[model samples]
Target: MLLTPFARVIPLPETIMRCRYSVVAACLIASFAATAEQESIERLEVQGDFRRLSVQTIAGSIAVVSEQDMQRSSAQHLDDVLSQLANINFAAGASRGRFVQVRGIGERSEFIDVINPSVGVLIDGIDYSGLGISSIAHAEQLEVFRGPEATRFGTNAMAGMLNLSSKQPDFRRDGAFSATVANYNSWQLSGMLSDAISDQVAFSLTADKQVSDGFIENTYLHRKDTNDIDELTIRGRLLYRHSDQLQWQLIAHAIEQNNGYDAFSLDRNRTTLSDEPGKDKLSSQALALRSDYHGIVGADLMWQLSWLSADSDYRFDEDWAFVGIRPGWEYSAFDRYQRSREQWTLDYRLVSDDQGRIADNTDWVLGFYVSGRELDLQRTRRSGTRLRAFDNNLQRDNAAVYGETSTALSEQTTLVIGGRLERYKDDYRDNGNLTIQQRHSMWGGKLSLNFQASEQAMIYTLLSRGYKVGGVNGEALSRAGDDGLEALLQQATFEPETLVNAEFGVKGAAIDGSLVTRVAVFHMWRDDMQVKGWLNPELGPEFAGFIDNAGRGRNYGIEMENRLVLHPSFTLHVSAGLLKSKLGPYVTQAGLDMTGRDQAHAPRFTYQLAGDWFLSEQLTLQASVQGKSGFYYSDGHNARSASSELVNLRLNYQLEQWQFAFWSRNALNQDRGVRGFYFGNDPRDEYAPHTYEQWGEPRRFGVTASYQF
Candidate 1:
């Protein structure tokens, strides 16, 4: 069968129709306040699980997709699905997908939080931290929490946090697997098995392999490098129910991936690097232990300890002539990074099982946390006789003590408050072989009031402070003749970045359980911002910039998330955001005015709309459309990249013991551009195009099958 260009595009007629209906429905409800039935139905919320509900309450600016949603959605990667959420964007240079940015904050060739991510990520309760934005395989759910949620998840949660949980054994001793072949010579095979090893223990294993012919072209080069990706993962868990009073669990996970970096195409909107591709590899191991005990006094105690180690190797030689061969310079870089991070937490809480007043009418929790990390970042670059080596070794020791208490002001109101005192110490070593020590301490607190407005509605207001520690740099050093050791000690000093956030929110369920809505307004202030910049020749081309206490930023925004259960067979989910980020006065190498510029990658407005329809008990269809307003790509702030939108669709069939589905992504094939700098004889003309590969998956059609026993 011959296929037309449009054959690859997913149909969005239903998506448009549903959007129109949503607008109409919202307007009708606003105009007919007297319709009590309409009002009740308009307040229905879509979250259906208790554990998920807990996550939502504290992980503000969060979005959750259930396992069922993953199965019904046609997405090749988690980021492909996440791009539909608000304020999230992906930048693929040439042919490689390298970084994930949330609220305009994260970017680094290596994963050490050099830019201090405003976003954080957790997979299966383990902090899946890294510099390059990679994808996860066989995930059960992806929980995204936007904004600085340091109080709960800690520092890196500055921009936001993503938590991924794999599916656990269901104790049914069931397993299934499937394979598929699609366009671009893409092939994938995946399967999993679960069974009880003993009366009190169970084990499960899942694995998959995938390969794809990348999309892009490099006229000067015969072979393209960025289009290949490979991954392997294994997870094991054991549960021991010692008794009603004591229970414990241990989990282990390991993963390895060899991913190509197409990053960008020779032409805009293309990523198929006809020449050589960049190489990126990531390997990680993690172990976690969790224990819980119920005391005689009705108190619950929980302890958790986790250890993780990850190593990443990246090699890129994008130049046709190793160096100085063409009108433009050839560039190549290699980086190796190793991170070992450990965390220990203890929590003890006293509670009254019955709602009737406790002996003290109070509930409390005591907690202590400690985390230590070792990071080694090293990179080597060679361009036309210029061989430069850079390395930074950073060690961090962190500890904190926290306490929270809650009291019922009345049957309809509750007040909660908590505080954490944290200390951070760092040891740094640079390429010149110089060493320096840095230390910092601070406190964060949260206060909130929750009011039950009625049986179906509630309102809450919260205020909190967040902090991120800073580190030293390797580029600044006065070299001694031999050993490349430093002659003078110019201590690299960076201060901590801090923010105070205040928010007010209202949540309600109405419209006969057909609709759910939540609205929140927030304001935040950040100080001592350590903005990032590129290297310039006049500044030596090797010198990185660090602006100390370079003014501040003010962020104010509104968020709305709603799910409309219009009918048992048809459901609609809609979310919208309006955000404003303003940078304060800061100095650049050229003394450029960096004030009032949108924080590097921060976007102003974002939204997502989706619908699910059951054509029959055996067949279902789903569609989603999402977009971001637009954002700046560079620190000097030269250009404003345009915003893009994506549309996706999926169809599924259910049978007694098997399931099958097909889906398409990036149906419109939109072009995404990034901001970069070109260093040459003319410094003023330094600005050049660093166009990114269009995120469009071209057009993909595949069938997936799974079974349960």
Candidate 2:
């Protein structure tokens, strides 16, 4: 795949055919109304649930973004594309955002713990949930599977899963080169080449490097790069086929990021006053190999092996101020944390052959999965003339056995059932006299019924269950000086949480494929719901954070995605999410009653309306308007971010195989917040509490040029 700033006219893969039927479908209007065109919307194949199926056959809420959809705009990272989707958002406190929230449930940050992500992230068949990905270099597709997926993935996918795939080697040689220059002293260069090395072998390689001065200005240091963005991603892949019954795939990727993190401002804007700005640095390498063979009687076998090694150093100013700001009374300090992590995974599966059904008309699959992780964490702090160090070692192991079966009850209906039994264990030890071990055995499953109403419409209902692993807080508890706070020690350990979800969805198209749409409504109940709780920040690092179970929780939402091919030259796309999330009877240690209140980071509504205008064979214009309602920033406080809307525009021109693009994101230049806090950092008012927000990107325009060969 090449990073061209234009979409290619490609054929749909595994799409539902046109059907002269009607279903009660409601679509949100994005722009002007249009007339039907002769062109049809493109369809995508989904690689979830251990099967390659179309959207109509998948029994859940799913969103797919292609290389063309991503490269058409100023979308460099996952966060840039999340807002265009429904009911998805991320928390940003690093070079790239770390926490990915689905339906208002997920971790907001990871400071003192090796937290288990509720939403799992897979990049090129390897798990990268421990760290955030900075770029999507030469990615072919991005798929977001919403709701519970415990039957397929164990604890890592309690909320959902995100799969990012890079382009594989093509049969024929193809490659591209791309470059871009934008505001804030930002520039990027990328190149890719792929070809067949032999009749049965093919290879692909891509490299991307992007650097920026960022969007922050430090007044004290007289520098504008206190918050910067610098990243490089290199990807390589190989595919080998011996015959129709066997194949092999190998993938490797490496990423390096050296970015600044002085984003907090005493003025609460894009300007800062930190004398010693912090840094965010990361280096990661990963490899994965997979093979499939059909030698077993009536069954096929598949296996995969993957490993990842990463090193990260995240540091930030503790005071958010300069030394002279408060003279001798200022709190001047730096907090830095470093981690080295290694992870490996192995998966094996057996599936019934295409012609081999277990029963009358049932297809079955069985799988076994196992993974292990080792992490070393180090924290160094400097306060004036004092320096303190802390070190910890963490280990985690997991194993699971899963199986699924699908049976055709009738020509128009099918029933699917799946289940998984998993075991998780965690061990932690630190130099500060804290040793903890925890283990859990859990199970999850799903039952789904599919009705193929027509060639272009499918209706399904699903009931699924998911679970999340539980672990102790090593950083905070390590500081627990054996003071009689045995009660706090008892709270240090929490239990695993589970989610049961029910969903009903319909996928269909009408008017000769001019109107393609999908709507899904889901409701989920959380039992022993896990939530991040704090003892007291003022009590030092010892009582900083812990995990607790809220007796109960509820999240329900409706998501819809629609494409209207009003005319051959113009198309309109709209995606929206309406959500209602509530925490059970739970009160914070600070006596903040949050029962019945909306969950943090859970917006009531999110929407995007976009349109494409093809003026000529060589020119195209795209525009979009995205908006989100305000929501609580944290559970400890009532501070919230304001509702905001953004407008984006892009114009592309194509000449043969060369392309040019003019793009601007947030063209309206709204001062929106990506993250916020309610804690006090002001010394002038004796550390009074106030809301501080990390403002989003400002208006910026850029030009991109690419050559495809």
- Candidate 1 structure quality by residue, lDDT tens digits, 1-709: 0111212332222322233333334333422322336443321122311112443233245667665555544655665666666666655542344456665555523332344445656665666655332444455667666566555556766666777766565456867676666666677777777777766666666666767765544444554435566666677667766777887778778777777655443344553332445666777778888776764454566666778888776655533222233334334333333333344333222323334234556566566777777777666655445666667777787787776666789887878777777787888886676788988887776787776655555566677777777766444342222232232123245577877776656565553666666655566677876666443434222323332445687666666777778888999988887667768777555567888777766678888888999999999898887777777666653556678677777887889777777777666665545433333321123323343323445556667766655
lDDT of candidates 1 onward, in order:
0.59, 0.81
- How many pairs of residues in model 2 come into backbone collision? 0
Q: List RMSD in Å for every model shown.
A: 8.8, 7.1
What TM-scores do the predictions have?
0.83, 0.93
Angstrom error at residue 617, model 1? 1.6
Query: Per-residue CA lDDT of candidate 2, range 345-460, in tens?
Result: 99899988776786669999999999999999899988788887889898999999999999999997999999999998888888877788888899999998887776566777
- In TM-score terms, candidate 1 sits at 0.83
Candidate 2 — what's its lDDT?
Answer: 0.81
Model 1 scores what on Cα lDDT? 0.59
